[model samples]
Target: MTIELYTWGTPNGKKASIMLEECGLDYSVHPIDITKDEQFGAEFLAVAPNNKIPGIRDTDTGLTLMESGAILLYLADKAGKLMPTDGEERWRATEWLMWQMGGFGPMLGQAHHFHRFNKGKADYAEERFLKETQRLYGVLDKRLEGREAIAGSYSVADVATWPWAARFEWHGVDLDQFPNVKRWYLAIAERPAVQRGYSVPSAQDIPMP
Candidate 1:
């Protein structure tokens, strides 16, 4: 049975779609136009109480889920792929996932909002978030100094964070400044499943705010 994916094409939304694609899961995409406030509708709120895009309902198990990080982990476990089964490797993956959820994604999101979308400059907010975003990029670069993937493997941690890094230009990031992240980002971008996932809901479906 196919999962019903309620999502848009933004970073968080792309995480779920990318994980599903990587797991070879059958799914149907339903675009949630956040720009039009579709995410706040009661129907969507039933499954995603936080009124966020990237929720999913699993037809095979009647399970509904929200939060991109949690969804990625669930899909990874279900597929028996992408995550380490036990011990240090497993915790390591979780550590990076939390790092993305708590810091990277949120900082970049604020940078995007203030730098690109805000009506006025909002100087303080813009600078604060952008600086933080760049700092987080540097952190990732240091972690990837000699590694191909975060957590030492292409696991859900990568799935959770790559989309955000992929939008470096939008966040005013120069990949050259973070060469390791640039290398890792380019490597993941070449994956066919990632390419497909990044295009989910289609470009035309994304509405302007």
Candidate 2:
């Protein structure tokens, strides 16, 4: 089945593409240029009412989905790969994925906005987000202290979280400071599927810490 992947070149967008690549799924990429307000177009709105990047239509199942977290889980189940099958490992994977969704991604996005894009516009916002960004990184570092992957193996949690961490520079994060996280990030970065997915809809080098 050919999946229709509607997305832009953003962290969230890369999540779906990365999962697709990892699953060895056949898919077509339809670039939605959010910078040009293309996401608001009626066609995309039909697929993603939230007007966000990284929505997909699975021709095999005729299932349309939005939200990066949900998409990762769906693809994992469909592929029967990149996720734990049962018990605590599955829930652990889900937990870390939600951690990325709830805290890491949003906080890092704010860090990008206040610290990178709109620097000097708001000192308080910059400091606040940056502090939170570092805190979240510490949490990740601790979680990764003795693990190769977030949950256990190379699962959807890694797929969901790695793209955001790829933008560590934008968040002004020095991966060197979070040693465990740096190690985990670098290892995941070396994956062939991750390298392929990171460039979906366009080609861009993955940033090194």
Pairs in steric clash, model 1: none
Task: Give the top-scoring candidate (TM-score).
Answer: 2
lDDT by residue (11-51, candidate 2, tens digit) is 99999999999999889999999999999999998888999
For all candidates in order, the CA lDDT equals 0.89, 0.92
Query: Which has the greatest lDDT?
Result: 2
- Give candidate 2 regions above 4 Å deviation: none
Question: For candidate 1, lDDT tens digit of each residue in 1-209?
Answer: 67999999799999998899999999999899999999999989988999988899999888999999989988988889899999998999999999999999988999988998992679889888988998999999999999999999899999999988878878878888888998898888889888888889884221111
Q: Residue 159: error of model 2 in Å?
A: 0.6
Model 1 accuracy (lDDT, Cα): 0.89
Question: What's every prediction's RMSD, in angstroms?
Answer: 3.2, 0.8
Model 2 weakest lDDT span, ten residues long: 1-10
